[model samples]
Target: MDEVLTCENSRVKFFPIMMYAMVMGMSGLTIMYQKAALWLGFTDMIGHLLMMVSTTLFVVISLIYLSKYIKYTPMVKKEFSHPIRLNFFAAISISMLMLAIIYKEVNVNVASMFWYTGTVLHFYLTMYTISFWINNNQELDHSNPAWFIPVVGNVLVPVGGVGFASQGVLMYFFSCGIFFWVILFAILLNRIIFHHQLAVKFMPTMFILIAPPAVGFLAYYKMYGVIDVFATMLFNLALFFTLLVAFMYKNFIKIKFFISWWAFVFPLAAMSISAMLMYHETKDVILLSLSYVMVGVTTMVISVVMYQTVSHVLKGEICVQE
Candidate 1:
């Protein structure tokens, strides 16, 4: 009994970096509902409730992960060096970025702090992650949509950085994100078509493929305040991927739950928000209906995943060695 208790206590040492994805999903949902409130005339109560819950989760998870880092420093370093886990380090910064956006309206000063910190951290990780990819001899099958988390995260800066940072600064990150996205996307496509399918545990990460164009559309519109031909292309590309993923839903539903299932939440949140943005800009009735549908699906998915995560944690199914 003592040994079993000791093992249970040790589980915290294996806390994975990708766990930050929870904050990303929750924050994405918070932002999604907030946008729905503005665009669809829904009560902001749901948005506020989600914000409070996500913020609390962020704080609690941060503390727990920090403890893991402090006590299991070598294990943390090993995960950092692992080709796959390295990409997820950016989830930490992405969580901060999402929080920054959520708080921008509630408190600009707080939001500005999160934006600056998240921007600087993500930028460093981008350089390091890309450099790691260039320098290392990595396997082709190692490439997954999680690769997008590090460098392509540059696209996220502009959405929250508009008034807080200079236009040139925002433009620099946006360009890097977009340029890298296409290059990495081609590589990911080749892997999917030529290489073996992603492992069952990672299949859910396919959802990440939806984020770039959807988020790019949002960031671009935020920077320019206009919907031009290029913006239309980005939004359309996102919609295409969204449809593709939805078509694959049968395959996804058969897979067992992994924390990677959280991957399903945030990209749909981006697409849902993108749909709302398109409606806000075009006021097209179809776009409004799409936004409604996306919002409903995203909200339901996040709620379900959150419940599954809690269930798994209680079962001690998460944070185990692979």
Candidate 2:
């Protein structure tokens, strides 16, 4: 019984807040199918089912994490303060942001509630994270693509916020998200080139590099409703990063599974959504074909990750101390 509460088998006491990332992934998948149903003339059935699953998981995960917080305040505090783990705190806000997008089609009232709450909470998290960075002397190894988790939520605002909020308000979030993306890119690139290679566990997070520009494209397209030069740049850059990650498949395939693998889901979904947007704008057959490929790949990737996560959970592998 002591071992059940205190040892590596302690699921509740050791529950990681990072579980929120799953909601982000599943939500992205839901939105991707929603886009597919509308734009590609596919049925909305898949999107609807995914929406139910994502929302259910979000509620369940939130309750579990909240229990962990109440029962193990010290552990929760430590996770919140750790330089790397601290970044995932934004995933909570991001999950809310994703949920806002998910519900925008089905229920305006529910969507608005999530949007206002997520928007307010995301801004606070962003400010807190930046402040933490300013005050703390961060180690270089702690610099991974996961750092973008906070900034990505900002770029993502306009995608869901355009109808709910004023243009200027949306612009504020977009501007901060885009500006820091470049700033953080330089820092992340330097660490990857001149410093130590990322530990194997973090290798999956490299896929996160594909997200900002892809989400930027969607957000920008939503704001402007035009596929201008800047929109083109953001979309292509996201595609380039997708190719870059694909080329490094060997690096990813060998690494043992970490919960961090959820890092792959949203970015790929973003790229799929971006491709669908590009096809919507250009009406290009090539891009339409590419969108189908992306949708298929994103579906496969998320499904595989979900299977792995469940397998690990039943085996008592997840929520163990790292």
Candidate 3:
């Protein structure tokens, strides 16, 4: 029993545990830049500086975590099969894409490199994740919003791809992403309705349900340069999910702090960006005001999470795997 406990403890501590949260930090900074430039009509020098810092941290931390993950074969196997841990691949892909988007305005060649690399990596990771779903002997009772991560990465591809890749490539990725989002949305809704309830610690990931359509709206706008009926539908769906999640705020408040709390950050940031895009397109003062409100809210939430995370680290509470 002691041996098994120790193994389980180690698995919790050293898992690719915090990468997804780190990606939230990265995405927040990127969206900050977008909010500043697109809505506020400023250069956002601070946003740029923070984005670079976040990117550096992502590279260094990822290298360290990957090195450690490679040494622990059992931990690696667990990551592949674990529902929550599997979303780390989505975090990685999104982080790479965030880098590409941040750099695209500053350096197109470098942006292209990150974009292509992330696209290839995300494709293989999606395949591997799906293959596991098909072949694993375990029951599929653990489905959650995090399951959308793999396919969500595809929806996000065109965020940077529209500028760096061909139209054909962009359409292929967008179609795959949207298709899977439909299928997974059904599967996850069924699980929520009929299967075991998600643990309190994981309820924060339900915010992930907002990301596909929010990011998809932004990506569609990038590709087509118009908020057509489809784009309107995507944006409205994201808005509906955002409000729906907000109505569940009391449930979120009851849960204690965990790295998974960061799951709330990026999705909010994506919605903020979507709002800013809407404001730009329609010149609607209401959306413009909403964009400002969302930027402030996202910044505050991320700030609070960063503070709590640092406090935990200093107290050595975050070192153990939970």
Best by lDDT: 1
Q: What residue pairs are clashing in model 3?
A: 12-321, 13-321
Tens-digit lDDT track for model 1 on 103-153? 999999989999999999999999999899889998988999999999998
* Candidate 3 global lDDT: 0.77
For each candidate in turn, give its C-alpha RMSD to the true structure in angstroms.
2.7, 2.9, 4.5
Among these predictions, the greatest TM-score belongs to 1
TM-scores for the candidates:
0.97, 0.96, 0.91
- Per-residue C-alpha lDDT of model 3 across residues 1-322, encoded as one tens digit per residue: 1221233434444745545566656566576665678577867776677777777767665655565576766776777678657766667877777788877877899888888988988898888888877886645467778877777668888988886778888988889889999998898888788888888877988998889999899888888898999999999999899989988889887788887888888888888889888988899999989888878888887888777766765665664665
List per-prediction Cα lDDT, in the order shown.
Answer: 0.92, 0.88, 0.77
Identify the superior model by TM-score, candidate 1 or candidate 2: 1
C-alpha lDDT (0 to 100) for residue 218 of candidate 3: 84
Taking all chains together, the TM-score of candidate 1 against the true structure is 0.97
Query: After TM-score superposition, what is the CA distance of residue 311 in candidate 3 from its true location, in Å?
Result: 1.1
Where does candidate 3 stray beyond 4 Å? Answer: 1-18, 137-140
Q: Pick the winner on lDDT between candidates 1 and 3.
A: 1
Poorest lDDT segment (10 consecutive residues) of candidate 2: 1-10
